[model samples]
Target: MDIANSALRLAERRGAAGKAPPLESSKAQVELANARIEARTADAALEAARRELGLLWGNAQPDFESVDGKLDALPQRGSLDELSAALGDAPLMQGGRLAVALGRALLEVEKSTRYPDITLSAGVARDNEAGRNMAQLGVSIPLPLPTKRKTPIANWRRA
Candidate 1:
């Protein structure tokens, strides 16, 4: 479509002009540092796993001790901007966000259900000897007028 073409052209122009909205530099630094730390940790974990496996079979360490990959540091990505989105969308962060939301929703539910459920009952009875039918409707709900306050307290503590 013409609109799509124009939007693509606009994006290209903005990219060429290097006029993209600036990202929060502090956030970017923290995010990138965290990412690097995670990378190093994961690398170390993998090496540990390998060492553990070797130890299981009693394989000796390499005599020379030359590591093919450097553990010191990783080369920086050209665009921290590019990585920001991926980090934000990472599974760990997503799960944490969902967990917080669930906690809040649960707290709301607990607050709403401070009392017990309301119930309704309907019944019909027929007596053959009397040749008459009787119908009745009733409703019953438990009331904890003296609120225990446990549910809200628990939900608050969890939240």
Candidate 2:
């Protein structure tokens, strides 16, 4: 479809550029041919998709002449409150909510298990001849602690 439209645009531009008469006719013919080819390709693709859909439904071969349905018809949508009420008592919706809560709980567990970037080192040195011994211990921890804040803006009001 895009290719055919581009060819048509090119033909129009060539004609507007005051090209030779013969070249204008040739471009028009090419554009027409491209359009025809695109239409045939689109039809074949749609038919193939229909056949594939039939096969997916356990049909060996699709013998339907033409699909009968309105592609533009939109389903009626309920109000938000009604939809919410419907979902509140639905088993599937409840399960989905539970699953989401479980997932979040698991995520929190995973997050809590993460150790902060820190390092600890200990070293001991001894000089037997001098009868001197030194021990050193060091610890390093990251600063500027991470924090998360969430606020709902819907309740905010100007004074």
Candidate 3:
């Protein structure tokens, strides 16, 4: 589901200019995902049909009609140890870490913008008949001070 959301966001971003990346790649990714999901669903349903089959794998495909009844079986906000044990393999923690990593990367990117990039250019020319050889060098540096940082601060504040 997370992959699907990311792929959808990528597709939307690519489509912003009235076009997108090669349709073949996008379609292949989506179709392959759909195939995997269908296979998992079929396998889970097959496994759920038998009593011991359900216990061995613990495939918890919820029944829509019995969802409320199942939830009513548990009390709210109790047993932190059991909750942590159940969430021992949490993907959410990884997501939080990724968010923090991306935040740090964003900070670095902003700082990079604060220090302007430099470009160097040089040219060499010769006019043999005139007996003149000339060499020139040029350096270009963006003036970051003109930006004054206030706008960037406001942007961050707004965010």
Clashes within 3 Å, all models in order = 0, 0, 0
Model 3 spans with C-alpha error above 4 angstroms: 1-88, 127-129, 145-159
Best by TM-score: 1
Backbone clashes in candidate 2 total 0
- Candidate 1 vs 2: which has more TM-score: 1
lDDT of each: 0.70, 0.74, 0.69
The superposed Cα distance between candidate 2 and the true structure at residue 102, in angstroms, equals 30
Scored against the true structure, residue 124 in model 2 reaches a CA lDDT of 93
Worst 10 residues of 3 by lDDT: 60-69
Task: Between candidates 2 and 3, name the one with more favorable lDDT.
Answer: 2
- TM-score of every prediction relative to native: 0.46, 0.31, 0.40
lDDT of 3 by residue, 75-130 (tens): 67759997888674678877888887987687677767767779999999998998
Q: Rank the candidates by lDDT, best first.
A: 2, 1, 3
How do the residues 68-140 of candidate 2 rate in per-residue lDDT, one tens digit apiece?
7788998899999999888888999889999979766766665554556688999999989989998989999
Candidate 3: pairs in clash = none
Across 15-124, the per-residue lDDT of candidate 1 in tens digits comes to 56776433333344455566667778988987777777667668755233334667788998757888887888999999999998988898788778776888999999
Q: Return the TM-score for candidate 2, rounded to 2 decimals.
A: 0.31
> Which of candidates 1 and 3 reaches a greater TM-score?
1
Model 1 misplaced regions, further than 4 Å: 1-67, 70-73, 127-130, 148-150, 153-159
